[model samples]
Target: MRSHGGRVRAIITGEAHIHADKVAAITGCLVPFPNYPAHIPMQRVDYICVVDEIGDPAKIATGAAKPTTDQRKLLMAEYCTQVVANTPYFKDGLSYQTGVGGLTKPMGNLF
Candidate 1:
């Protein structure tokens, strides 16, 4: 079970649906607050990828690290291609670096 900003989540690895069942059972049993009803809204969530193995990260020695000549050339070529594709819009005087930043307020502060 997990909670994201007051909304609870329950994940099931196997076929056991025990806790959800309990939540369903207790939703209606409130002796003190009979007028105030309890509700448990369920939603199915899914993960896109399941990565099993990861290669060891390449370690860099103490220095100003730079990509190899071949790597730099390849990356530069890709960047140039993207820039060329966007050149038409740039010619119309559109600045590229607009609306590219982190959230103005952290998610926790929003609620």
Candidate 2:
């Protein structure tokens, strides 16, 4: 944009990901703010403010945002839970890892 005579006074954003830094390197300043703008802070593009909850939930994860739920999957989760329960690893204070996927969704509820 600078090459095209475009001016970037500030960048009003939430999290400062890699893209934000790239812009900051060329822009005037970087101003990181919360997801809600009416709360506080205004200026940007020169400095970077890494904060939390700066993204709009409605806009975040445009695709594959919603979780999956179905009777077949639930039944499968129930079966899997039972199998896990029968395993020796299902003891107290047991720790397990799971991915944010459809199959794991129902399993989480069971646990």
Candidate 3:
């Protein structure tokens, strides 16, 4: 978690053994947030899968723009939901690492 001024940012990352579509489906199943803007800090998730003879390696990467206070809540909800729904594959494959803010928070209030 990172904080800037009076706002706090948190990123939750995990993996799933399912396809990208399925992950997106799970995200839709979770919460509905508005479109992500282009200038926000990015949070990505990757899913890797392998099925016996049929190897289906897949990944799901999602990002949201710097959110408003309410939007931050939505993002947290979505992140938590995604992590819980795909617990079995959490520690496998690639790890999900997200950075908040612009590398490091600026010295003063950025309003």
- Count of backbone clashes for each model? 0, 9, 0
Candidate closer to the true structure by lDDT (higher is better), 2 or 3: 2
Q: Could you give candidate 3's per-residue lDDT for residues 40-78 as a string of tens digits?
A: 222333332333433222322123333234655555556
Compared with the true structure, all predictions reach lDDT values of 0.35, 0.57, 0.35
lDDT of 1 at 18: 40
Estimate the overall C-alpha local distance difference test score of candidate 3: 0.35
TM-score of each: 0.18, 0.43, 0.19
**How many backbone collisions does model 3 have?**
0
lDDT of 2 by residue, 1-111 (tens): 332222322222422222443223222333454444322233434544555546675674344543456778779889998999899889976776666566775787788
Clashing pairs in model 3?
none
For lDDT, the strongest prediction is 2
Off by over 4 Å in 3: 1-64, 75-82, 92-94, 97-111
Predicted candidate 1 versus true structure: per-residue lDDT over 1-111, tens digit per residue: 344422322334443344443322222223453333323233321212324434322433112332333555455545654665566554654333312112211111221
Model 1, 57: alpha-carbon shift in Å? 38
Instruction: Give the TM-score (vs. native) of candidate 1.
Output: 0.18
Return the lDDT, model 2, position 98.
61
Best-to-worst ranking by TM-score: 2, 3, 1
- How much is the lDDT of residue 8 in candidate 2? 28
